[model samples]
Target: MDRLTAFVSGAVQGVGFRWWTRSQALELGLAGSATNRADGRVEVVAEGPRPALEDLLARLGEQPSARARPGRVDAVVDLWTPARGVQGFRSR
Candidate 1:
């Protein structure tokens, strides 16, 4: 399994980013949580197959929702090591 933490910026908050992420992650069978950060960024941490993680990142960059417009979505991803098991994808 592979783990990744993605920090998504731009017009993310209040635009259903977290919900979109949760739906996509669940579809990919990834385990993680997508949360809104106090700094106006959305934080997504996921664990699953490397290919699935890569696919999730691609979907995020491609604007998974109609609410995410061009030049309004960006993400920074980093390899992560989870301290505990993530049961399922969630929105926070």
Candidate 2:
């Protein structure tokens, strides 16, 4: 198990970014949340396998498939750590 906390920036709020993130996380069998921050960034936190978390991070950065990503993603800064075991994925 692993934990990934990704800070997504650039045109990410009020555009279903969190919703898109929740879908991706749930598809990868991850448990976490995507939240809109006050500093014009979206914070994505997921707990699961490292591979899955990495995939999620890539997707957040809009790699492999730009059409799948919501809004315009300029960058995604992420951090990996031990999993804290979340319940389910959500958009908040």
Candidate 3:
């Protein structure tokens, strides 16, 4: 399993980014959460197979919605390891 925490900036907040993330994560069978930060960014934490996580990251890099364009994605770590206790994908 792999865990990833990414901070995404740009027109993220209020543009359905969280929902889009949740949907994609679920489709990839990833467990995690996507939340809107007060500083105008979206924080996404996902745990799953490395390949699935990578695919999710790629999806997140795309436009979340017609009105939302992602500017940057800052992954906290380049490598991933198993993270215990994550259940299901969610928007928070």
Candidate 4:
């Protein structure tokens, strides 16, 4: 499995980005969370099969209504083993 962390910049917050992200991630069977940063960016961390994770990232890049305007996505691939279970994706 591949773990990914993406930082999205632009008009992402207050635009249902987190909700959309969670929904899409669930559809792709990814486990992670998205949170708004104080720097006006949204940070998303997801872990799953490589292909599925990529698909999730693609979906996030094009969320139709909540997609960031003039957005920038920075992604990194790593390995993560959650000490405990992550229930569901959430906005925090």
User: What would the per-residue lDDT of candidate 1 be over residues 1-92, giving only the tens digit for each residue?
Assistant: 87889998888899777887888898899999999999998889999988898888888787544534333576665656643567878899
Q: Give the candidate number with the greatest lDDT.
A: 2
Could you estimate the TM-score for every candidate?
0.82, 0.93, 0.79, 0.72
Per-residue lDDT over 28-83 for candidate 4, one digit per residue giving the tens place of the 0 to 100 score: 88888989999888888887777887777666665453543233344323334432
Of the pair 1 and 2, which is ahead by lDDT?
2
Using lDDT as the measure, name the better of candidate 3 and candidate 4: 3
Task: List the global CA lDDT of all models.
Answer: 0.80, 0.88, 0.75, 0.70
> What order do candidates take by TM-score, descending?
2, 1, 3, 4
Model 2, total clashes: 0
Clashing pairs in 3: none
Candidate 4 structure lDDT: 0.70
Better of 1 and 4 by TM-score: 1
Model 1 residue runs over 4 Å out of place are 63-71
Worst 10 residues of 3 by lDDT: 69-78
Per-residue accuracy of model 2 over 1-92 as CA lDDT, tens digit each: 99999999999999888998999889999999999999999999999988888888888886545647778888889888899878988888
Q: What lDDT score is found at residue 90 in candidate 3? A: 83
The reply for model 4, stretches above 4 Å from the true place, is 63-87
Clashes, model 3: 0
Candidate 2, clashing residue pairs? Answer: none
Q: Which residue runs of candidate 2 sit more than 4 Å off their true CA positions? A: none
Query: Top model by TM-score, which number?
Result: 2
